[model samples]
Target chain A: MTYVTDVPEMAVAPAGGPPGHGAVPAADTPTQWAAAYFDGYSTVGLLAVVGVLFLTVAFVGGRLLRPVVPTPEKLLTYECGVDPVGEGWAHTQVRYYVYAFLYVIFAVDSIFLFPWATVFAEPGFGGTTLVEMFVFLGFLTVGLLYAWKKGVLEWT
Target chain B: MNDTLEVALRLLAVFVIFLVLPLVIGQTEHKVMAHMQGRLGPMYAGGFHGWAQLVADGVKFAQKEDVVPANADRRVFQLAPAVALLPYLLVLVAIPIGPDNAVGEAIDAGIFFVLAVMGVGVLGSLMAGWASANKFSLLGGLRTAAQLLAYELPMLLTAASVAMAAGTVSLPGMLDAFEWWWVPWQIVGGVVFFVAGLAELQRPPFDAPVADSEIIFGAYTEYTGLRFALFLLAEYAGIVVLSGLTAVLFLGGWHGPFADELGWLWTLLKTLALAFVVIWLRATYPRLREDQLQKLAWTVLIPLALAQIALTGVVKVAIS
Candidate 1:
């Protein structure tokens, strides 16, 4: 499908091209301009389309090649060697959620660390950057210490 | 036209990663694991050393019965394996296989892109467990979600430290950052990445989710035929992707003797060596209990990773 035209007439004005020269007059229209903007992502879009197609083919091929054999016994939920009892859903521990919460805290901290790393290496920013990062860590350390003291770190 | 050709070539590389490497690496794991256990592996499958064992296994899996449990969520059960497998292929698109052999477009945030995409496979496992309508599968699925989430923190922290030290998160950019001196500074981060990566991959010592004896293959307990094959494929592919990531992040990716002429070979060598280490860990270590696994991640690895990041920051400040 020719979703975005490749012709230069369909092209929006270059970022700083001469005012009226080579700029499509229709580019002022939102739909056309939006399509042009989206043209940049066409490659990624194509990749996704291709990926979905590939998966479809694999699943279809498996369906074609594989046999379908079903019996009541064979279709029963597996409970090791025993007969299954009750519904599959069961209460999961609350601790998993706690761990997830702790992860979020650290995850945010790590994200902040990335930009800091980039800027910290710039000239004359070293000492102040180091001190600021330590202060940030001191707060994170306090949170961690609280988690530790609360026995949230214990896996039991 | 040029962009189309690049995307096509990248898709071809993705095909090779998904289709070809798994067979070779899976066979290597089989033979290696067999030897470690004091037996010959796949000695008779193909003339040499059962080198074609994976191909044979593929055919067998292709023809086996596709059985879904009576009580299972039929649609999700069927879709879970594909969900698991596809993300790894997408991840390959962002990974540079060699110095100049990046398959997809160079993403500026390549490392983060990889970590983000890789995490989606957990959804597939969770789906598999929930859809199977089996208690063990449910338990396994829950463990996968918990374990993966827990391990991902240290893994991301360690990778962030690498990105920090290298001053870029792009795979190719990090490769460019590698110099002799950067190695010493990254050792701690490198070790953390490898360990946490192993946990993320659910390889041994961290494989509680699929502990066969305890959980009957966990999330995969009810899978049969090609569906089961897809899960196994995802796993082996995950090993390759993680190893490649480890190589790119920590080792000087595609950098070796004569790397300028044929850097892809060095990248392959490093990836295979790391994969071997993963297999070695599988053979040597006993599986940690669920609590021990969490304890190690929360207490040991996370703190060490945080400290390593601080150290990386200090060192970068000191050097610059």
Candidate 2:
């Protein structure tokens, strides 16, 4: 799963253990890479499946062991013992969504930084990528600054 | 057949850790929080310092009725616990405890995968909030969405800084690349990462989303019995993952005396030590106001994380 070697060969090799002692050698060809990619992800998928199974088993075991007695009062939405008031879906502050929108844009943009970071220090790529990233980040900063100036970042 | 057996054993090991570590953290919190507050917490439940308090709690939760609110969206409300609990388990699979691929599954883009999966975890609370059909639940849900969004950037940015510094995205690769000097070099990013990760998990100080005084457990207000317990367990599991990550990314995980033979011990000790700090913070600080929480994330953590990234780049270039 190591991508250290996957990056174009650097003059100073990236900080990976010698082959067989460190990271599993990344596949060379595209086909092998994809296979290796999914091979790893399949375990993640399996874990997710196992997680769901574990929870389901716990819940079922609870159901089998627990008592079931549902009173209307017991099932009511708890509001610190107050009887239900207006609808549960109350209108929340619109300000939250504004920040959420800002986050979405910035988050999507930052995703590019991950891969860039992996390759940023490779000898030949160092200067070029560093300048390129700051340039990219400069644009992101402008957007953040614009939002800041617009008072959109204000939480009130 | 041998390979399958090895995989099975590894999966089993991960499963055991996923189940057990949270309980360990949970019990530790019970006592640590008690001692910090000058009380002896849970001294009776399991005999020796209430060691089995969490086990007792699990039994108590199981025997209790699984209550779903009458006004709730039944299926989503019921499903929310699983959604919240599973991502941490998925993450536990990828965190390397020692060198030589000591991980449940080593994804190529390990850091990216971890951050992405953890980001998905917030949806569990959002879903719980929405489906519970309670006003407080909705508010809590909305707060979670906003806080998670606010902090996610710093978390990602800081992680990217580490990945950049290490020159790889794999967790083991990061550990393999870890130099003791990184403890000093990446300290700022490490703090920001841990703080932001805490905010992401909605742990105290950042736990406005579930403030019991204001929202009555927020997204979990309507949950009862085993369902509520699952949410609590998810939180402890989150603490373990976050601490483990902080250990690997900054603390030079498994890089102590006699590291080769005793690497896993070092990693575990570091993680537990950080987890203790987490509990200490909860005992020491009151919850922050919602606005204050957002302001800190947007104004402070994000900028610090960005600067850390730039610093890492400059330093890497200088030495290279």
Q: Against the true two-chain complex, what DockQ does each candidate achieve?
A: 0.40, 0.50
Measured by TM-score, the strongest candidate is 2
Q: Candidate 1 chain B, which ten residues in sequence have the lowest lDDT sum?
A: B99-108
Question: Which segments of model 2 are wrong by more than 4 Å?
Answer: A1-27
Q: What is the interface RMSD of each candidate, in Å?
A: 5.9, 2.2
lDDT of 1 at B151: 87
- DockQ of candidate 2 against the true complex: 0.50
For model 2, the local distance difference test gives 0.86
Q: Give the TM-score of candidate 2.
A: 0.93
Error of 2 at A138 (Å): 1.8
Q: Over the stretch A42-70, how does candidate 1's per-residue lDDT look in tens digits?
A: 54556667777877886788889877777
Assess candidate 1 and give its lDDT: 0.79
State the lDDT at B26 in candidate 2.
91
- Please give, for residues A1-156, the per-residue lDDT of candidate 2 as tens digits: 254322223211333324454544444555555564566776677777888788879988998999999999998988779898987987765756778788899888888888787777886887888898788778878888888898876866
- For all candidates in order, the CA lDDT equals 0.79, 0.86
Checking candidate 1 for backbone clashes, the offending pairs are none
Q: Which candidate's lDDT is highest?
A: 2
Q: How many steric clashes between backbone atoms does each model show? A: 0, 0
